[model samples]
Target: MTLADTAAELRHLHDAPELLQVVNVWDVVSARAIAALPETRAIATASHSIAATFGYPDGEQIPVDLMLDMVGRIASAVDVPVSADLEAGYGDPGETVRRAIGLGIAGANLEDELKPLGEAVAAVEAAMAAADAEGVPLALNARTDAFLRGRDRPRATNIADAVERGRAYLEAGATCVFVPGNFGEDVIAELVAGIGDRRVSLIGLPDIPAPARLRELGVARLSYGPYTQRVMLGALQDLASDLYGGGVLPRDIRQLN
Candidate 1:
């Protein structure tokens, strides 16, 4: 399928109740590999991985154009739905919507924690308006960082604020809500129960609570951010060291050669 076709399919799938597994791809090669998987239906880009590929940190170092280009390349290589981690919506919700639509992306991850909660809500509202104007249903996954960073901090203050921010984000037109960070079963259950019947999407790491468990807890989608890339990098380093240290290359090397 073409990228546009995949986008359409993804938009349709967003409404379904079944869990969608979105694997994060760093480059064209990894994107292609994930696309080849029979069970894979959609792809997500990890900002950290993308920045690392360009020798930059994940702290908004790379320009928006560069990130969009990388996303376009990955989208072109795969026939599956491609959703990008548009960190903070690359500034300016309207412009971000336009750029993503131009790149043939079905959806994007938007966060409501860039600034004060009020500002974040406004940003999401602007993004939704932009997407509506573009005539493309951009699945905006509103992310909250509370559970990921503040759970152990001033527990009461953080949890309360997170729930409030998440509610505001939903009201601002977020199709899904993602609470990242290490969350315990009770927390996860509370979030799932709290969001209750709102078109919210929850995403968690594979290493955390099991994917199946998250699904049972009402998570709409599961994504393994940069875990796969990290694993791959480790394997490559080990293999290269073995080859240079008098170890024979595996049979797979012959196939590539």
Candidate 2:
């Protein structure tokens, strides 16, 4: 599909009845694996995972050019729609959004990172304008770090802050509001209620309810983020350790050239 078509499909997935479950990928291999899944609808890139693959730490440590290139490669390798995790829009939200769209990405996540609400709002506005000029209707999932940063605050206050930032971002042209770190079913419900009609994306948490339950709670999207990558890497480590201990390698490993 063309970039516009894929973007439209991704945007529709956000508002679809079933929760959009994204198994975030960091590279071409992972992207293809996810794309090959019959249950996978779209592919989202994890910025943290990508940074690690490049030997950089998370928090926008990866250079914007390399990040864009990696995302482009993943998009090229898969037929499914690809959404990029463009952290803090790489300090230039508008240009970053434009480049993402230009690279055939269907959507992107832009985190606010505890910035002043107004500044984040402006960034969203600028991104929307850039996408409009490019004639690509990109799905921009504006992420608020309120819950992540407000662990010490009262629950009520944290939820309130997240909802306020979420609503403002949605009004500023965000396709969805991602509020990570508050995974309880009740808090998730509150976020859904607080956002009111805007799609809400949440990161997966251990104690959090299942995707089915989250869908029932009105969550529009769920993502594994860097956890998926971490799990895969951990498995790789275990495999290497076992091999070093003279354990037999799996048949798949033997087949590798």
Q: Give me the candidate number with maximum TM-score.
A: 2
- Candidate 2: clashing pairs of residues: none
lDDT of 1 by residue, 1-257 (tens): 54445555775665566677788888998998888889988889988799889988885678888988999898777777888888787667678767877788878887765378888888888888877787776777788777655656776565566677778887887777777766567766766666643344555554457767766767677777777789889999998999899999776543211
- Backbone collisions counted per model: 3, 0
What lDDT tens digits, residue by residue, belong to model 2 across residues 1-257?
57888888999999888999999999998898889879999989999999999999999988999999999999999898898999999889999999988888989999998899889899999998998898878888899999888888899998999999999988888889999893687888889999964379989989778989888888888898999998998999998999899998776653211
Candidate 2 lDDT at 178 equals: 91
Worst 10 residues of 1 by lDDT: 197-206
Q: Which pairs in model 1 have colliding backbones?
A: 148-181, 176-201, 177-201
Off by over 4 Å in 1: 1-8, 149-152, 197-207, 253-257
Residue 16 CA displacement from its true place in model 2, Å: 0.8
Model 2 error, position 163 (Å): 0.7
The all-Cα superposition gives candidate 2 an RMSD in Å to the true structure of 1.6
